[model samples]
Target: MNEQQRTILAIASRVMSYPSESSAEEREHIDEAVDENIESADIRKHLRAALAPLDALSTRDIQEIYVSTFDLKSKTGMYLTAHEFGDSPKRGAAMIKLQKIINEAGFERTEGELTDYIPMLFEFMAVSPEDAHHERLQRRLANVGQRMLNHLEEENPYYPFFTLVMTKVFPNPTDEEVARLERDREEADLEELPYPIMYQ
Candidate 1:
């Protein structure tokens, strides 16, 4: 998998591993028990390791996560309520408290950008239209995949690799030009390719 994919997996794994809440036995649970935690900083170490190869993706990464995850899916109001809280005064207060805790742990809080919001959109849809969500997301992925393939072709000067793959799958194409090139695959492979796009 790509670096971003690995980072996403690492974060997902960390969240899955962390306990959301814990309860204690009766009596004397108060008075200065556990020290403030560096959980976020610890987790950030893993996240940074996984995402290091994707340094170019820093600015756009969070936005992609938000978009893919937060789709409005439920009528029960839970997800929407949480999403709304971020924009409300109560949430602001909560965020301050949360940030303090994280800061004490030597970790910084970061707001996701526009692309990150897309994941939230997906999550929203999943909660609402259970069956349709899978299909919709599938189509979206395919479209994006195709675009990536096209991008690879456009950015490369060694002849279009995508076109080569495509026309090969359809040998009886109306364009004999494609057939002719297929015969000269070695020649095409010898051409110089350009550098890939730098995300930054």
Candidate 2:
């Protein structure tokens, strides 16, 4: 990792480790990690922007957000795959009957893979002892796992953007055009915003 990536990771570590009931000193530490040293605002910005038109896909899309934001590149022979949930994100319980479908499959999990994020896991334990077993938290770990895998190769802090597909910045020109126009209107502070979104 470069200086800035390291700095941003430090910020991420702080954010991930932030207490729900954080103290003044803890808040100050987080602010210092992000405002004073970290340059990852754009990274967070791009991620929020990317999720806007994604239809808020549950497991995979959310995991994609972290993976892309943190630039987790897969290694050869080490595949990260998920059960295909094309258009919906849902939750049901109370011995819900199986619908001939699994909700989502986890990424490649192995002994070696654990090393990529064990420290982060430890840090997270310090922060959210409750979330240690939450399903959402568990799914997001796939992203963190990918981050650990690629942390060594992430030479440029912003290069992680390549993994994203913001509807506005995505390949389709129409989407890009729409995003650009929306940006212009927002910049102008127009009273009636067409896109109606507050871009990150």
Candidate 3:
């Protein structure tokens, strides 16, 4: 991808991550990105709208929202592979492969965070040089990203953030493709075990 696309992806990665507070440095980075990419006006507007309310909230409130929205809720999970593979061996294998790819790209995985975390995918996109490996990784991520978007409630504050990432990664997901993703999300929801028995 070009410099503008790289910048946009990096900004989105930071915006979608669980932040304790809206630091001035983060805001400045986003502002500089927006200023540089006039062609991406709609994306910039959507990102600003999504982040405005988040920026106004206190650190504690933001943390609560993050926990409740992502931690407490299964449908809005940030782990992309979990939506498709659940806790099965498939998900574990996928995670291993993804970690390998991320390592090969020279991006360090955050402790306690899976390689398939949505923000990490964006980070990979931002740092990895454009090549066949990047293309394959992006394609896989785009598929999982759409599935995550399907699971997210439209009214959720983080919905726009995921939507922005999906649009950037997928660009042109077909209607049929979205229908399949929605169906997969529904099936996954049905198969999900109750909270108490989930780990057993």
Candidate 4:
């Protein structure tokens, strides 16, 4: 990825993470990154739009919106594997695989956050070297990111941020692939149980 792409991915990762009182500093950095790195006026416009509320709203207000948008709604959760596997053992396996990839790339996991969290993955991709493993992982994340985008309302402030990030990771996904991901996401949502039973 180029400098602009890398800069935006890093910015998106932080902006999409849970909001904190200290986020004003982050917003300043985001503005600077846009001004310095982002060349496209359209993308700059959308990114600034996505972040405008952060500048206006208190941290608690942003936190409440964050919790409602991603935490309360399982379909819109940042944990990407949950969209594909729900609460299944398959989700656990996928997370383990993702953790291994993060370890191999030497990207440290955020405390109290799963490796498959969208922000965690974005942070990893921003700094990690591009390789076969990276490409494969990007494809997997692209699938989940697209589904999350489909779930989100276009008017949601974060929607443009996600669109920008996914655009960089999966620049030109085919129509057939998009259809396939939507179909699979629907099937997974239907077939996977919300709470699995376990026995010893």
lDDT of 1 by residue, 1-200 (tens): 22233233223322212112221120012111111221344433544343333233333443342222222221111121222243345545544554453355444433552321222322222233224433443343323223223334242221232233222211222345334323422222212233455896
State, as a TM-score between 0 and 1, how close model 3 is to the true structure.
0.77
**Root-mean-square deviation of candidate 4:** 4.0
Model 4 C-alpha lDDT per residue in residues 92-143, reported as the tens digit of each score: 8888888888888876798988878888787788889989888877777777
Better of 1 and 4 by lDDT: 4
Query: Lowest-lDDT window of 10 residues in candidate 2?
Result: 77-86
Q: Between 1 and 4, whose TM-score is larger? A: 4
lDDT of each: 0.30, 0.33, 0.70, 0.76
- TM-scores of the candidates are 0.21, 0.25, 0.77, 0.82
- As a whole number from 0 to 100, the lDDT of residue 135 in candidate 3 is 84
TM-score of 1: 0.21
List, residue by residue over 39-142, the lDDT tens digit for candidate 2.
56775465434323332334454444445433233221111121111111321221121111112222232235322233243233223323325333333333
- Residue 100's lDDT within candidate 4 is 87
**C-alpha lDDT (0 to 100) for residue 25 of candidate 4:** 84
Ranking by TM-score: 4, 3, 2, 1
